[model samples]
Every structure is written in structure tokens, then in C-alpha cells.
Target: MKTDQEIMQNIRTAIDDCTKGIDDAPSLQYQIARKAKGEEPVVKKISTTIVLVAALLAITAVAFAATNGIGITAFLSRIIGGWNVNENAIVAPVVKENTSKWLNLTGTEAYWAEDGLSVVLKVDSADDEHVVCYSNEDGLLDETGERGEQIAINGEMAPLDQWRGEKELIIAEFSPLGEGWNWYKRTDDGLFVIVTFSTPDAEALQKGTDVAFQIQDTNIQTGETEECSVTLALPAMTMQEGHK
Candidate 1:
């Protein structure tokens, strides 16, 4: 059996490997703008997005280590301490709800700290089997089969490209944060995804900002693609205290 330290070391290594070439990660602004303008964007695998969160988590760990000097174990505890076995347990105090005919966004929990913002989304769909895909200017790329999707923020079509010049707001990371089976499992009833957005300006994000979260899915038999989105009105920022 692996010791706790050993496991953490392994995680660190995985994070390093996953984030090694983040410069190559798809450009968020360019792709989204291309699609908005009716152009086809480059193809990127879904794993790229998933690995992104891993990289962000790794970055979060590093930031915590720099401040607390405790270590990764303690950092992990501090970040996920609110997680409950039931999954539905209310973790963050600021929660919201949005639903559509095809997609049911059951719950959204968000928190903001000195470093950045963390969001957890609980989604349910009516389709028996849905293919989650990423949209580029060219068209939809199946996450399970083709691999990549355009990134969005606060329902606005703006891409990271536009903000590259702005030094104040930096999108350190944005991707689905999942673990074990939750990472790969796709079900009709309940699907949970964790998304983390890091920036130097946590204050701006925490002060009741409006941001859009978007996801695209395709029906297998019908060959119809649907775009679903939720606009979240985030409340004021709060420091991450002890586990909720």
C-alpha cells in the first residue's frame, strides 16, 4: 500500500505531467470567437480540458504551499473538506438553480477565495444517452469520440484571446474537476462537474458577477445537437474558512 505522502507525491507527478505543455492547450478566445463568427476552430481532445483542471488543482496546491508551508495533503484537505459522501450535500453557501426542457441544472455551488473561484455543478438530462461535445468554428467535436469543445465564460461569447493583453484578470484554469468514476461516468439522471476559475482578481469575481456556463450535447440516434447554458449571479466573495 502507498503511504499518504507517497500518494501525494504521485498526484504531484501526475499534475506536472498533465500541465507540462499547457501553452499548447487550446486558445479559449480564438476558438469561441471563431464559432461565434461561423468559422471552424481547430480540433482538441476532451482529455485536454480534463487535464486542464488537474493542472489547476496542481497550481492551487502550489499556491497553498507557498502561503501555508504545510504541504499538499493539508491543501487538499482544505479545498475538498466540504465534500460529503452524499454528493448532494450543500457544500458552498452560495447556491443557484437553472433548468431547461432538455437539461436540468439541479444545483450550483460556488466559493471565492484570495486565489480564485471554485464551482460545482450538478446536472441532469432527459436523454437516455447523450454525447457531450465541444463546439468549434468548424462544428461539434464529440468529447468521448472526437475530443474538444469551445470554452465560455458568463454566457458571453468573449474568449481569452481578448483578455490576453489585460494583466489584471488572468484565467489560470477552467475545466471539469472530477475524480475516479465521477470523472468518466456519464449517466442520464445525475452528472456532476467541478469547475475552477483562478485569477489574481478574486475580488471582482466575488462581488456578485454574472457569468455564463455553457455545455453542448448531441443525441446519438437523432443526430441533433443542443446547446445548454446557465447564467450564474455569483454573490459577494468570501474567504474560504474551514470545511463547511
Candidate 2:
């Protein structure tokens, strides 16, 4: 039986040979080295060849695991260490927020990449019968159905149909990922809204930038609308390179 040193050497050689010519080989090598150093005692009784096979299998397993919903970019992020991937996008840390009587901001997340900027806001409302509406420009309909508008980023107009549109800025109802789900849960006090925004020029709404949202809180049962404007500070973002 080969000594531990020899076994480790063989494992290193096998990993080097297998990862040779790979673009992310350097990162893989570093991770393998770190793993091997920490696992020396655990593999002490194992044969050199078995160790080599196990290491190779580990690499394969990682690649395979990424295919099961977790993206390759996220897998690499975990191995190389840098960003956090959510829904195939590298997201920044959650930003703290303040609360208002109508809209209570819970949490915020933002991601900047070559594709564009993605922002997700978790919000709560106290009005059980209220419907939240958004507009990019002034002249939004007030509670009495009077048309009014608000200032928007870059003079862009909010999509006519907040739920479906190709507009630059869109604020839609949040639906959790899954199948067969209609109607969001309604509590005694309020409801939760997951607002997502995707825009090519997301950089405009940088940290400390206050974005004015023209919101109409309408009572669904009575058609009564309470129009209000809320300015939310864009949370700090964790910018990362775009993934192909």
C-alpha cells in the first residue's frame, strides 16, 4: 500500500491532468488542493487510485449537480467564491428598508450585470382591500379616477398593463415559483408583494437614488383609490460580470 504522501500526490496529478486546458482549471485546482489538505486524515486508509477516482467523481458530481436547477455560473461562484446566485442571477446582499403607513418595505435585493439590472422588493401592506398600482410618469389616475402623472426615471413611462408589457420599467404582481397557483394569500392585516424590476439602464437607480413611485391604493370592493407617492432608496448592489 502506498503511503499517504504518495496517495495525495497521485490525486493531485489526476486532478491536474483532468482539469488541464479548462478555463476554470485554476479555480478547480485551488479548491481541490484546499479540499485535499483538509481531508488528509479522512482518506488515510484509502488506496491512492481510489482517492484519484473519488476526486474525479467529485468534480463530475459537482457538474451534474449544477444541471438540476442550480446554474453552472452559480456552481462556479460557490467553488471560486465571489457572488451569490439566485434564479440564475448573482444577487447582492439584502438591503435594509424603512416602513410607511401604506407600504411597508421588508427587504430589497439588486443585481447588476451586462444583461441589465434586476431588483426584487419584498413589501407588506396594512390595507387588506387595497390594490397597489405603479406608474413611471406623472398623470396617474387618483383615488377618484382623475388622471395624474409623476416623474419617472429617464422620462420612461410605466407599462400600460403592469402585469404584461415590454416597457423599460415594469412593476407586476409577485408570483412565487411553482405550478398551479392562483390568488395570493390574504391576511387579516395585509398582504405581501414581491415586486421585481428589470431594466437595461438599471444603473440609473443606484444606491442613495430616491425613486418616486406613483402608487394608487384602491379598495377592490368599493373601487375607492387612495393615490400616493412613495420614494424608495435604491439599495446598494453587488455588481458582477454577466454570465453567458
Candidate 3:
């Protein structure tokens, strides 16, 4: 388990050792000119090429391990301080079973604010056609603006240009303002989404804080509402980020 710096250093050392005293350089420009002239351009031996490729692969693997590993791990890291969710969030991997037997929802990360809580949920459905989704303006409209004819919000059909903001929309079972918005994307294994809302009580949050919450979603096909409950407590920023 080498640190990034150590791994880089090891790669550098290997490259140097492999290319030791093998200065076949006529300069890159000159080598290219030689090749252009139909001459055998100066090149490293196959062993050296193999070493370089291996080193490159190792570097790539390290980079991926450092910050791009697995779906859930990267999901938590990516939204740690964005989307109204911040570092003060307590990120716990929660596999909460939804009411629907065909689908499963997991809370990968979340944060509690005075207003309420925001949770990142990953949905895995056995039947692709029976996937879970929270109907909103964005999801209703596709690239060709097809759903434009019939707009929907909060899993219910609404008139075109019918306005609904966070204040008017209350989504979660326990949230003061459910912050109902359709925000989700597809993943290889399942669907990734973020659920945010206002809490009934505005409680001051400090480090090592724990809070419980419930997130709900509806099926587009069957109009079935499913909920997953979870509690998260982790190191949190006491104050809103970028403020005193």
C-alpha cells in the first residue's frame, strides 16, 4: 500500500533503471526525420517498451485507486462538498431495503443541515422496466422534448409551465421542504440519485453529528411510492462552507 508519492517514485526508479546508460537519443525531432526518410528510427528495445507500458498501467491504477475506485466510494467522494451537501456530512454506506420487492435502494452518503438533510441513493432494480424514479420537470422532458406535452412534478402530472419550487414542494415523509427535484443518472450496476429536503426541526449541527431521515421515490410505470429510512452520523462542518 504505497502512497501516491511513493508509487510515483517507484515508477520513476523503474524507468530510470530500465533505461540506464541506453542513450539512443538522436533527439525526437531527428528520430522522426530519420523515420520520414525511410530509415530505421532510433527506438527503445522491446524490454524497455514493456517496462514503460507497465509503468504507465501502474500509474493509471494508482490514480484510479487514489480517487476513482468503485461506484459507491467515488460517489461519496464526489459529492462530499457540493450539491448543498458538504464535508460536515456523515457518509455511511447504507443498504436500506425499499418497500418494493423488485427494487433496492441504498444510501451511500448524506449530510444534515439546519434546514434538513440530503441523501445520495443508489437504486438497483431486478427489472429494468420497473425502475424507481421521482418524477420531476427535468425527468419528464427528454432530448426531443417529448414529455413536454404532458409535464409531471412529484410523480403527478401537471399543466405546462406549472411552477413549483422548493418552498411549494414537500417530498420526504419527515422533511419540512422535501426539495423535490428530479436529480439522478444511470450507472453500470444501477441508478444514482440525490435526495434533498428541509427537516421539520432546525437543529444546529456540529462535528460527529448523527441524524435519521427517510427518502421516498415513485415508480413512473406503476405510480408506486417507495421509501428508505437511514441515519447518518459523521464528522461535519459546524458552519456552512465558505462562510464564517
Candidate 4:
């Protein structure tokens, strides 16, 4: 696996070799690259078309590393320890959303790598009353601060009446259940989440795969649980159409 520095250096070396053939003065950026050249090689005159093609590689190596403000990058940083749009990574803009009761789940981006598949989600509702929780015991506590219930929420073990700050919460951990889903960010309209799954099917997902997970909401008092199975059909992404 090549680091971003390695990638940039390789591209610059290729660009330097390309400039030697051009009759025209190389751009200032390319000029700087030439000074770092190692042993002198045979200089053969080449067409400007080849130089432009080499420049494209330089753009892809450097520009794609920055995601600007993307939720997918946030999740990736946790796994990789930093921001990196590596050669093996695929970041594609996608819209695959579903709604269950008042809870609306939207898939904004798709990230595929060797480990598994993950989708960046935006979870919202018609109102602000519910908090995210898992049904399992090791997860969030029940509304009454006990361990038995179908509906879930971040009860904070204080019971229903005392619950506060529901708006600013974003789920950090994914479910341990089959095909787990994930974290979010506070948004004016709603929250952004990244649903991740652990599977050995990276090869299959990269070719396009269908994924589904449970997303539910609970009415704290009524205990009425509206659970929906959200399905995401991430499109097939190739090397040429990736990292943007």
C-alpha cells in the first residue's frame, strides 16, 4: 500500500520525465519537480498530448485525498487513523434512502474497501423526540433504565421523564447484530450516520451489492416501536470512476 507521499512522489517523477520532451517551457509546478530528478536519463522529444495525460495522474493523486466536508471521510478516519483516499478506496456519491414511520434514513455516500462495506446515512424525523438505541442488553438501556424492551433509546439510565438533549446526540457504535448500522452528526434538518457491516464480501460489494438493516424508533411513553428494514443498493464503482 502506497502512502499519499509515495503517490505524489511517483507522479512527480513521471511528470518530470514527460517535461524533458516538450519544446515548450514546462509549467512552474513541473519545473520544481524537475530539480528533484535523480540520475540523468535520455531525453527524447514527446508530444504535448502526453504531458497533459501525465498531468491528469498528478491531479488524481493529490486532489482526491481531500474530501472537503464529507461524512464518509469522518468514518474512514476512525478506521485508518487519518484522512486518506487510498488507491484501494472508493468514495462515490449515492442516494439510497428509506423511511420507517417518522424516522427517515438517507444514504448519501458509499465507501468500499478490503475490510467491508459501509454507507453514510442521514437519519431524521418529523419531530425531535426519539434517541437512537440498540435492542441488545450490552447496548443502550431501556426507557425505565432496565434491560427488557423492544423499542430503544439513549435513556442514560434516568428514566423517560428525565431524558434531555435528544437533538444533539449522534450514535457512535454500530449494532452487534447481523449486518450492523452506525454513527451520525447534528444537522439542521436531521443527523448524518454511517452504517457499517463486517463481511468478507468486499469483492462482491465493489461489483454492486444490496444491503439491509433495521432502523427503528420508539415512543418513550407508548413504547410503540416502528421498525423498518432499510435496504441500500450501492452502485458498481470502478477505478476510473472512484475517489471523487
Candidate 5:
């Protein structure tokens, strides 16, 4: 009869030999003939266990190869065919038609506009937040003077007298500062675009950085003195085949 220590040593040796592909007994053949006659056969049991483990490993390797693309052999070919595009195309210059009367309000030196609300050309110190354009829905400033009531910004409504500054106010009820003054409009392009400008201020300039962030490009542009320009990508519609 093998002692407990001897059985343990045999088990350890069997594990090591299995990993090294070595076999001290007939490969995976469990000779249980003696065991069926009431005799213990430990070696046969160890052999069966190693064979079962080896079979499992073989099956796992086959499954892994099938799931993960064996290697990068089809990498380039797959990407090219998977992604195809219509490369034939043309590039045309975008033209705009200007209709707003305020485009060149300061002077002819302003930036040229192809579309009244598509873009704005301005002299130096341009205010990118005051230009008026069409609004699809009710906006901060509406087309009718009647809807200017109840407008607010950052939760605060503009004071009546100071709404459009004293100069822009024509009537007490129409003042931008009025309780419901709407000084903004929503554009057909699905956005709100306003343009406002201010003269050089020592206090506003002394802050070093810009206090008024809405002034798109306040710096000077080439070929002109005191020139500034701002282009707004508004939500607009296009004709699709049948729709005009």
C-alpha cells in the first residue's frame, strides 16, 4: 500500500510531467482491471485527469482562433471594401445676397455682405451682437413692438429707460428697457444673432481682457483700418428635389 506522502509525491510528479508533455504511464489509458476486482488503481485515475485537461485545452484553442481573427491577414482588404465613397465632386464659391440696410451703416469700408443675416462686415470695434435678422419663433426682440414685453436675460429683465440707451428710444412704451422689451430675434437658421458696438472705453479697455465677449473679432483685419468681421452660421433651409 502506498503511504500518504508517496501518493502526494506521485500526484505532484504527474502534474509536472503532464505540463512537460511527458508520460510515465500509458498515455490516458486507465487500467482499471485490478480496481474492478476491488484493488485501488491511483495511477490510472491521474492519467485520465491529464487526458481530460488536454482535451479541454485543445477545444479552447480552436474556439479562440475562430472568434479572434486568426491574425491581421485580411486587415487592409476588409477596411477598404467596408468603406466606399463617391469621390467625384465639385467645389463652388458660396454667394450671399445682402438685404439689410445696416450692413454698411458706418461706411463703405465695412466688410461686404452677400447675405444680410448670413454675415456682417463692420468697421473696427464691431459689436457682433446687434445685427437684426428674421426669427422663426418669438425671440428676445420680435418683429412687432407689441411683443417686446417680458424679455429677460440671465433671469434679469432690462430696465425700460436704459434698454436701448437714451438715443435709441423713440417712445416710452417702445423703449428696450421697458418691462417686456424683447431686443433679440430668432433667425430662420434656428439661432439668435444680434450685433451691437461700443466706442473705445477707458474702463472697458482697462480691464485688459475683453469684458464684452460677444464682439466676435474685435481686432484689426488686413487692408483696412478699424475693420472687423463676423460670420454666423444660421439655421436655413435648402430645396430638396421636389420642395422649392
Candidate 6:
């Protein structure tokens, strides 16, 4: 293949010689001879009329779609990530909220304590579920305290390492079963933070927990000091009987 320099030289000669009269016809023919010699001539100019017509058509199409609120931008994003977001997929908004409610100490209680990490919550019903959500630099680190990739939430594929270099957060929704805790982390900030809730059946609960985190709006500021309550539903079997 000819390098860029050789191609430009040929084009320059062809254009410069295009103005030559019949007296220079032989030279003009010689300039473009390289094109037949396996050197692809460069195209510097396209028909402006055709380009303008196409541009106008595109503008009209986009304007029509905008007026009707029909677009493929979101659908395209999901398909690229191996996600099939149903046109009717349910979307639950993750709102930053604050609640004064507390778990009743006397209610069924499940304690999560593994060596140094411990968390406690009272179990009453699915309504008693709570998810502890906070973003920290250490969040990027695995339970072993070593840096690790974030897990999936709702069967979403693994995130490209390139996109996970920043701060991350997960919402650990603890149910009554209380033994093995499963959690989902939202990689992207948005109104509908997709998740796969645990089911009562063993098979359903055992479905490896995690999903892809889609970025919604990173503009959702953190550390605002405005605490919020998040509700997560879970199956009763997820909680196990434990000491009070």
C-alpha cells in the first residue's frame, strides 16, 4: 500500500494538471496513471448537493422523532451490553431518601459477623428489609481488602476495567434468611437501578447474585448528608432462624 505522502502527491498532480489544455493532455494522463498502477487515488471532494440533501433528510427525521419522543438511543445502549431491556420492563427509581424508622430489637433478628465485619438487623417481614448503600474509596476493594472488580447486579455482564477506575458503591439488601447475604451494586446512577431480587425457593435464591451496573446520572451528588431509606424485597427462606 502506498503511504499517505505518495497518495497526496498523486492527487496534487492530478488536480494541478486538470487545468492543463490539450497541449498538456499527455501530462494529465501521466499524473493519474499511478491510479491504474495499483495506487488508489484519494477523493478530496464529494458532491456537495448530495451531501446537503442527505443532511436535510436526516434533520427532518430527527426533528420528527423528537416531537414524538421516539428514539433508539437507550435501546442501543442495552443491546451493546448484552442486555435485553423489555419495552415494558419495570423500572424502580432509586431515590435518595431519609427515614427515622429502626428495626425492632425484639423482632426476629439476624446478625452478620464475619471475623471483623459485622452488621445487625431485625427481621420481621420483607418490609423490614434494608439496604446499606454508601460509596467509599475502599468499596473498590474486595472482602479480602484487595482491589477487585465489582460484581454484577441483575445478571448484567462484567464491566470493562476501563470504566471502573472511579469510586463505586453497592446496596446490600439484607433479608430475613440472615445466613448468606446477597447484594447488588449500581455501577451507573439513575432513576431505575435494575436488580434481581432474591426468591423464596432455594434455586431462586442461589442464582448467583449480581448484575451489570449502568451509569444513570453521575451528577447525583454523594455526601449530601441527606440520608434516605431504600426498600428491597426478598423471600422468607433467605432469612434463617438465629439467636435473638
Best by TM-score: 4
The sequence of per-residue lDDT tens digits that candidate 5 reaches over residues 101-213 is: 22322211111111111111222111333322222122234324433543233336654334333222211111111121122322222212223222322343223212111
How much is the lDDT of residue 241 in candidate 4? 28
Q: Model 6, stretches more than 4 Å misplaced?
A: 1-83, 92-140, 148-193, 198-229, 232-244
- Lowest lDDT 10-residue stretch of candidate 2: 177-186
> Can you list the residue pairs that collide in candidate 2?
137-150, 138-149, 138-150, 139-148, 139-149, 140-148, 140-149, 143-225
lDDT of 5: 0.28
Error of 3 at 118 (Å): 1.8
Model 4 residue 219 distance off true place after TM-score fit, in angstroms: 1.7
Clashes of 4: 1
Task: Return the TM-score for candidate 1, rounded to 2 decimals.
Answer: 0.37
Candidate 2 versus the native: TM-score?
0.32
User: In model 5, where do residues sit more than 4 Å from their true spots?
Assistant: 1-95, 103-144, 147-150, 167-191, 194-244
Q: How well is each residue in 94-210 modelled by candidate 1, as lDDT tens digits?
A: 334343345545434555543345565554444433322123321223434342233243233333324222221111111332221111112222234555554524555546565
Task: State each model's CA lDDT, in order.
Answer: 0.44, 0.41, 0.48, 0.50, 0.28, 0.31
TM-score versus the correct structure, for each prediction? 0.37, 0.32, 0.39, 0.46, 0.19, 0.22
Model 5, position 231: C-alpha lDDT score: 28
Superior by TM-score: candidate 2 or candidate 3: 3
lDDT of 6 by residue, 1-244 (tens): 9999999999989987886676645565664776677575755667997687556645655554466453433222222222222223212222222142322111111111111111112211112232223222212433343444543433354542433334333322333232332222233431111122223234432332211111111111132122224433222213222211
Model 5: which ten-residue window has the lowest total lDDT? 107-116
Report residue 182 deviation for candidate 3 (angstroms).
6.4
Model 4, span 1-244: residue lDDT tens: 9999999999999998887767575555664456557434446668997676556644543455454443433343233212234544545534444546556565666665433455666555545765543233422455563543232232233442333344422122334236554554433333456666756255666587677666655554355656556677766754322222
Candidate ranking (lDDT, best to worst):
4, 3, 1, 2, 6, 5
Per-residue error (Å), model 1, residue 228: 3.0
